[model samples]
Target: MNFFQNLALKYSHTMMQKALNNNLKVELLKEPQAKIAKEKSYMLYAHIPFCHTFCPYCSFHKYYYDENLAKNYFESLREELKIIKNKGFDFNAMYVGGGTTLIDEEELLKTLELCKKLFNIKEISCESDPNHIDPKKLSMFKGLIDRLSCGIQSFDDETLKKVARYHKFGSSEVLQEKISKALGILPIFSIDLIFNLPTQSKEQLLNDLRIAKKLSPQQITTYPLMKSNLTKDNIAKSLGVSFKDNEFEFYQIICEFFKDYTQNNAWSFSLEKNKLNDEYVSSHHEYLGVGSGAFSFLDGELLINAFNLNTYTTLIKEKQNANIAKAHFSQKERLKYVFLTEIFSGSIELTHFNHTLKCDLEKELFIELKALKICGAIYKEGDILRASKFGKYLFMVLMKDFYTGMDLVRAVFRDDARLKNKDFIDIMREDVDPLNAQNMEFKA
Candidate 1:
């Protein structure tokens, strides 16, 4: 990226970050009316926030595993699901993300069975950690899950140790074997990777790509390391590595590796376009988000569930929804959001933009489009706008910044959700203290 391009990205990110802060001035909610036509096809997003262990780099809502607490959480999850069904709302697809979607086999299966019985869901996608992939578990998830996205941040043992995953999950070889066991069992199996770790080299990045290609899963999703305050600090101090954003260079390597794979989302590369990766936004425009810490974006309104587990369970039992805050974006902002989602998915057809959004895409998003063009991020073919090679990196930047902003949002509510530990600091301690090995010590 040149000086001008760098400046453009920084400025755009700054403005968007500012806008996010201003727009997410969430208000308290007693009842959230998240209703849609029964006939309309939409996606269902369920957030399961329990895991065996917590990664400091992960900013999404999550907690350590506890059986009794998990049982209660899943009960509330079922209540919320039933409430959505009672409201005459329907969905055609479901996506479950988490601390670890498969943390508790029984609870997860129960939830999936209920979801299948309640709605006309055609496919279900769930996230997993390498440790959870076993033959017994794979056999159980046969008909319950259509797609399983396993987090393989890096296949290098040294990198794995740096992130403290070596002890928690396993070495690269163990993880590879565990992940490989899922092939042919599920319809769509995806490898989730993160590039541009602060201390990762170009060769290290290439090695990750090569191994991922060798496995040849149905899909692969790669993200640039998002430098958020809490996560960056944890990774840097825990690993003794400097934090740098070498996104463009890292993305270039990924682009070269996945040149033939279809871009389902800016970060997602897949064998075919028919299968939906973990990103629910690309598959469905509007979705019903259920569970604590899940977000629902329907029409122009954003409904955020309570980040605190206790509060979420209470709210769901009483109101059948866990929403604690809400934000409604302006029409222009909504247009920009649609444009960003479309372009980030690798292409945007003007016809769908004009007809569905009922606005002049060129005029409404003129400023964003202009900056993207100047940065050589996007170009117009006939009526479609496709992201350029460099433009895809810009997409990564936008997504990283957007998610970093979300971390800040999580911080706002983190104070209330530290039920396991004394506070967030203590929670960070669990991840860092166990495997705070020096770079040389961690080197395999």
Candidate 2:
């Protein structure tokens, strides 16, 4: 790495560590309250932690699919939503994410139905794998889902095989057929691609992008692989993978190839106007998360649910909120988060920040904002601070650092939850030592 690039990476890493540490001193709440009174606009995120098969590179919380267990989990999920509703928090948009949220079609449909009935849901987006998108499922989701994102990590057969996704999802031709069928029914069809795999070359990444372009989906999200302790070993053993520093080159290729398309964020691009995209971080300042291992940002606090499925269901059944840990943010910390998310979404609106926070950004973040401008990472345009082409990559470094920090926290909690002991809650309250924090081996 060059001097400036190394400097930016180091700075972002430090800031991310600080942010993670600040949020690590969590409190175990006996009865967590869903704070939704102050925010007039927010989205609901429901996490389904179940998948038919686990990929070696994934870090999300998920369990092996079980018919009876999934059915009961959905029932508990419904009750959790009711708890939020009873607190007078209404949601208009919902995003369902997971380890193949459509693993069990019946349970997923039931959950979606309840979400619609409970709230005035105007738009709903769901995620699935290539294997789950069939004629039967597409028919059921025609009008109910506004956007359907399929995880087609890569089209390269070798890369897919190395990641343990090839056999489970089928060949490229099968995936294409499924994509075509979904395009005929879904309002907004999107596909996700992961770049910079250990075995992935520049040619492979370009080919993947070419296939994505050929598919002509309304939206495409190309993600960098973010590995945690849980999957790093598995990935290395299964794929002989090593982290590479070629992410910037791959990102540039996408930007150049899709120059005509609108940039939704650092990773997402769209061809159609008013299409649904996964820029949830920029869209809402506060959101409530339902289901196990989901995180929530509300009233200047971050709340996390217990990662254990059994404990989650048991807590909800006992008429208690599933929240196990809470981290409150300071005003400055909140402003910094807004600033970072806004910049990542393409620009920072100074007026909006000033109006919302009732404080001048130049004053609150004088040094940091000034440094960003002086370093040519951002430039001022009227009341907005926009990211330069180079700024996008630098901000991406920050985002990758932040997300890795989050995954590290999840990894620690996931391991603790596996013990199925009451002391796990107390362990979660303690801050993660900086030296002990799991660092991302790759740029992701």
Candidate 3:
């Protein structure tokens, strides 16, 4: 790395560590109505934390699927939606992510039914694994969901085996058949691929992209592996390989290979015109997250739901908010977040920053913005700030560090929740004591 790149990485790591360690404060809210009402526009995110098989490289909050438990969890999800509705919050779009969201077909249908009954949901996006891709499932989702994304991390059998997903998702040909069947049925069909795996080479990634392009999906998202403390250890132990820090070459290859397609974001490419991809990151400035292990951002505050499944259901049953942690951002921190998110979307409008934050962008983020420009990471075109070829990779590095820190925080909360503290305050006091009540404002 060059001197400037090294400096940028260091600054990014320090800021992310401080935000993770000191900014996030845990607390329980009896009623989160006032907080919910503050956001003018937002989407609803529902997380299903169960899967048929858990991959060792996975870091999000999830558990092995149980039929009875999943059924109960779906019912509790409905109740949680009712709670949000009662707070006078409605949503135009809903994004359901998970540990294989379509693990239980019946329960998923019922949950979508409840969503339709309760909210004026115009656009719905649901994520699934290859195991759930079939004509029957696609037919069921025809009208209920506008977009369906299948996680086909790689079509290479060896790569799948290394990740322990081969047996669960089957071979490349099997996935191709599934994708072929669902092509025309789903309105917006997208496939997710992972690049820069421990065993992945540029040739392998190029082959994966070729296969994906042949499938002719509406959109494709290529994600670099973001490893947390636990996942890093797990991947090394299972695959006997370590991940590399620099993926600039791999990212550049993708951007160049997919030049024919429209770049929707730093990582997503689309073949369809006027289609929305990367909804969670590019759709709304803020969103409300429901379900265990979900994160929500609103009015400069980040709210995280309890990671423990039982705790999440119990809190919902008792008519209390399931959010167990929150961090309120200072105006400067909020501006930084806005800028980062805009960069992820491929550009930032200087006008939007000025109007929204009511401050001059250069005046507020002088050092960071200037350094990025001087290092050729970003460039100005009229009123817009766009990520240069190098800047895109830099943004990815920043996001990876940010998410890795968050995963570590979730690990702490997961361990503490297993102790079964009577109140969230106890968890905050015992596990997150140093950061507690320092910059925290509780709604309890």
Candidate 4:
């Protein structure tokens, strides 16, 4: 990498980290949050936050799967959806993500049915794990889900075992068979792969790609190992290896390997047109997310729901809403976000940006654009600015840092949720203290 490029990326990391820390100093929301304009169309992202086993590297909010609690959670979610609809908001497209969204197949279908019935939904996307990818189960999702992205982070058996995926998802050979069976399940079938794991090697990465090529899904998303402090510490103890990134080399290999595949974004490769990747933020400028651990972005405000199951469920049931915290971003900050996302997607239309931001980009972002250009990160294509190869790599790093910051922010909110839980109305009774062992009558 050029010194200039490295310097620009470093600067961006620092700036973004600062912006994230500032923006995420959240103000706890009072009950019955204020309404906003319905001028924009939004993609709905519904989070299913229950996983059978937790992976050390993931930063998303998740809890262990509990069937009864999940049932109640879905019931609350449906009510929350109705409340949003009553607020005069509607969703165009929907994306279901999660601690394995397919854990309770029946409830999932029921929720999707309600969403479609309530809104004018054009398309729906869902995420699942390899263990849940059965033909019978997938058959039920065909009409409902346009895209199904399964998390298959690696195809190396030892790597899988290191991450504890081998026991849960399956061995690499079994995963290959499972993934092969998933082909043609939906309009777009995407499998996720993570590059540059703690102790992962170049040969292992190439091998994973080779297997991915053979499985031949409609879309494949290769992500760098994005680790937050929570995951970073856990990854060390769990994998017994440092949480490091070989981003530049691994990313180049991925981009080179997927030459025939269309670059849907910097990291997502697609075999077909009009298919969506898992990154909802890239496609939707503002999105409304429901369920525990969900985030909703409107204008410059970010609303976050409680991450705890009890808090989320109780809030939704009582208040008909689960929004627990909020943070505001300034216009400049919003523009910076747009710049990163648009450039990451390969190009930025100058006219669209100027009209939306109501500012002359050349005047406002002179230094940023100039720096990126001088660093060989972006090039001009008429009125549009496009990312050079190195720019894509920079974007990957930038986004990783951005999300890591979010995870750290979530850590704060999660703690806040625990504190705020005490003040909630009609609190669910518990025999044992979750935070303290004082209520544990079984304690010796």
**Considering every candidate listed, which one attains the maximal lDDT?**
4
- TM-score, structure 1 vs. true: 0.90
* Number of clashing pairs per prediction, in order: 0, 0, 0, 0
2 versus 3: better TM-score goes to: 2
TM-scores of all predicted structures: 0.90, 0.91, 0.89, 0.91
lDDT of 2 by residue, 221-336 (tens): 88887765456688788777655667778878888988988888878888866535485666677788899998888878888887888788988988777887777778888888
Clashing pairs in 4: none
Deviating ranges (above 4 Å) for candidate 4: 242-245, 421-444
lDDT of 3 by residue, 306-340 (tens): 77778889989998778876777787887787788
**Candidate 2 runs further than 4 Å off:** 1-6, 30-36, 415-434, 437-444
lDDT of 4 by residue, 28-119 (tens): 66663654647667889899988999988887888789999899999989998988888888888999999899999999999999999999
Q: After superposing candidate 1, which stretches have Cα over 4 Å from the reference?
A: 30-39, 417-444
Give the Cα error of residue 308 in candidate 2, in Å: 1.3
Supply the global lDDT for candidate 2: 0.78
Task: Write one digit per residue (lDDT tens) for candidate 1, span 1-444.
Answer: 788878878887877776665555555464655555546767899999987876767887888888999999999999999988887888889999998999888889999999999999989999999877787887898988999999989999988887788999999898888878878888889999988787788898899999998998999989777766668788786555745656677887788789898878878888777567577876666788888888888888777887788788887868656776667778988877667766778888999878876788888888878888988989999989998877877777776777776675566555554523353334334433222111101000
